[model samples]
Target: MHAKLTTGAMLLAMSTLLLPAAAAPDWQMVAKTFGKSGTETPDGVYRIGLPRTDLKVSLDGVALKPGFALGGWIAFEPMGNQAMVMGDIVLTQDEVNPVMKKLEESGIEITALHNHLLRAEPMTLYMHVFGQGDPVTLATALHAGLALSKTPMENAAKPQASAQQIELDTAAVDQAIGHKGKANGGVYQFSIPRAETITDSGMQVPASMGSAIAINFQRTGAGKAAITGDFVLIASEVNPDEQPRLFFMHFWANDDAVKLGRGLKAALDKMDLKNS
Candidate 1:
């Protein structure tokens, strides 16, 4: 069975279940204009996966899976005559500036530029963008910017397109982590949502649109796993000065599955400390 892709994309196309009885935008047209298809999440947000399969990155000794850390994605939430888009653009060191320039030229706001992992063969940077406008226009501009890089425009390799075997004990991972996980192209992913509502520019943004705590696990060896994801943090919990309101973290371990689960639990506890 193919993994239900909510935390991933290259294939953000159609809504799996029928949308609500209320009238909705022509998502099929939007998906076509974007040059890729996608799926709609439970929260009514539409997501497109753009995993950077072009990059062969390894953390420590384990090769990183595209869904683990290289998952590039764009999400759309409809708003009457317009829509809001948010996404992460994966770029190598050289592709950063040109892509940023292109995105800016098209009026998309570059919300962030940072690294998710520590040290890898070739370093990677992430660009976060936000915009609200016509769905087709936004897709056109976003596609133009992605054209500058090697990010695949085709959906043949999207996480949801195929059913890759997952050997890890994902059931144990779900129990230890306190939430069920979804498998996408052999990667086990968890999108942990918070208790409070999150809004951007006066509109509510759901956890599916990059607001939730994301934890991804991919098997590297026998009882050994490689994990990486972003922890959405609030500034008030800490000093709240100089620190951005949110924090994204990456963790890697090649030792044992038990130890990996323990460490991940500890990290989640700490990150969710204030909320709990």
Candidate 2:
């Protein structure tokens, strides 16, 4: 009976040891290191939005709002004892190289650097950064890189008082889109996940990594608004004709998914003929 009791206690201790460790993200340290507050998603990702309010951008003679073009963001997701960070930083032509150098020096990888818009008054570029390490260290590196640019560290810019009210029926828009949205700096923003799962490098990609379809609306007038943002789609879902052309499709002044789907299909068909 003593041997049996010893065996049972040993089994219980082993089972406890084999159990999964609790996920604990040091959010306070992350915020302190980044010098900005962040919002935690339901899935436990802490996301910080750093909009370039100092930039006054114009496209085709229309003044572009920060929500429309100058939004930079970083997200941290807990990965076991460490954390994984992914971010897109907006920079001017001159600021790009300096910021890139800072991030590289800090051991962050530059995944992609490209233009999000075709032609604007002052050209803008986006740098995509990825890093995995101690969460506070990652945030510190990110903060240092951002300091190289004119990007605001915190709520440095005062909110503009608008005489015009928001014209779009936001509640209806949310219902139609199947997701709730938040208003930020005069833009109604929605971050919606794909119905299907998304994976990268054989691992599941979370919505916090800018993998969700981001839609933004800036009110122009009564019942009128300018819409802009991108839709995240995988290769198979984006193009059925040509060799899987996976990319985010950015749209301006349009929010119809069916029309965009048709446009993508047509473009793919044309590419297929060219390849053939």
Candidate 3:
């Protein structure tokens, strides 16, 4: 009896050790599972987990930037089984080139460089960076790069907007993507299929199992075109250096050049997908 009790205690302790401290966040698998040639989803179909990044910054605390914009960048499919990144970047200022040079010197790839905003800030710039391995480490490197900027904290604010208001445009946007988009309070999003010819992470998604690009748009007014707002996309497999550049360029600098990115991302986060 004593031996059995001791064994049971050890097993109990082992089980306790194995348990995760908290429930892991359900990170939706946004990537497509493409199969071989001859079978693929339609072209221009977007996918999820294309490995992307978003950085939102503010100046003067006046909320100059938008939240959750994709920064118009994406990670390329891995090469020969290795990670490859591809995407675009829009810079805020002309001086941003020096920052890009610094990043490249630290082993990052600049896929593209440009501007999404017309005019703003101490002249912000966006750099599309690509690389592989250790997401957190990449984040660390990104944090390092951001130190070069004068933007303020990327603070997290409480969500605004309600679910009922979000449902207003669900049907309309859904029609564009060929499916019903989810309505979560203030946020409405739709993820559509990607062409089967597109493959990522050694996974072959059938035409039926294509990729998904989620768009979160907000409704600013009650009129027909009232839903005018920004759109957010999730690109999987994005590296760290690229993440910072994209975050600031695509999301943080939304003064007209960013379109509806700010309001769209904000509204989407307030939504409840299950309710939609």
Candidate 4:
């Protein structure tokens, strides 16, 4: 009986030794590979934003700021020993094919390629990409894809100073929104992630992966600015109607705080009704 017990104990020890050890993801390498800094969300996802500051886009004679309409972002989440990545890249008409080719050649899947707006000048397109592999490898692939376009790489050009002085109460706006925002190329931008989990393709998709509500305010004049951006949502959260709508809105303000509040509340009401 003693001999049998010894053999069983030895077998158990060997099995434990044979089991694969869990490895923590190297987030620094991912950021370095992408040529940008990143942050880890509350849901334990690492994300980086890449705004298209190179493009000068417009809609209906109004110039569209980068934060307003030309932002791209990538998110990384640990999955077992590897990592999963998802991103949406904004591309101009001429840069689409080249960037798509790069992404495809690097083993990244193009999940979607579509327009986010109509009647926009210089036509813009959004390309959604996905990959599952080493986080650093995925970032490298994304960098290569972005390089094919005019998308600025690290230190390509310093952000130009705004010619028009900002007159809006930015601090008040941030406090009212309940989140701090950053000023990028004259646009005050906020990225607020949902407090719930989002999933796609049987995998948990983090809020940083195009699942957050993006808000941008561009200073247009004294005590005035133009607000625009989109609320990212999954298919199930979208309204199933004849037009298949996703929540989106825009506002042009000129020193009218009450009017702005009312407009935003009305837009939210409409969105809630559609989703309901």
Sort the candidates on lDDT, descending order.
1, 2, 4, 3
Candidate 3 accuracy as lDDT: 0.42
lDDT of 2 by residue, 1-276 (tens): 334558888899999999999667789888998999888988778888878878988876668887777898999878776788888888999999899999999999999887788887698888999998889999999989888888887744455556223557999888988889877677888888887776655546688878999998887776777777888866556557655544455545466989888887787786535544
Estimate, for each residue in 57-146, the C-alpha lDDT of model 3 and write its tens digit: 333332232322323323333223233333334344543656577657666666556543433344345565665543333333433443
Error of 1 at 60 (Å): 1.3
TM-score of 3: 0.41
Q: Which residue ranges in model 1 land beyond 4 Å of their true spot?
A: 1-23, 157-163, 239-276
Error of 4 at 101 (Å): 2.3
Least lDDT summed over 10 consecutive residues: which range in candidate 2? 156-165
Estimate, for each residue in 91-163, the C-alpha lDDT of model 1 and write its tens digit: 9999998999999999999998888999976899999999998888998889889989999878764345456
Q: Global lDDT of each model?
A: 0.85, 0.82, 0.42, 0.80
**Residue 238 error, candidate 1, Å:** 3.8
* Ten residues in sequence with the least summed lDDT for candidate 1: 10-19
Ranking by TM-score: 1, 2, 4, 3
Q: Pick the lDDT winner.
A: 1
- Candidate 4: the clashing residue pairs are none
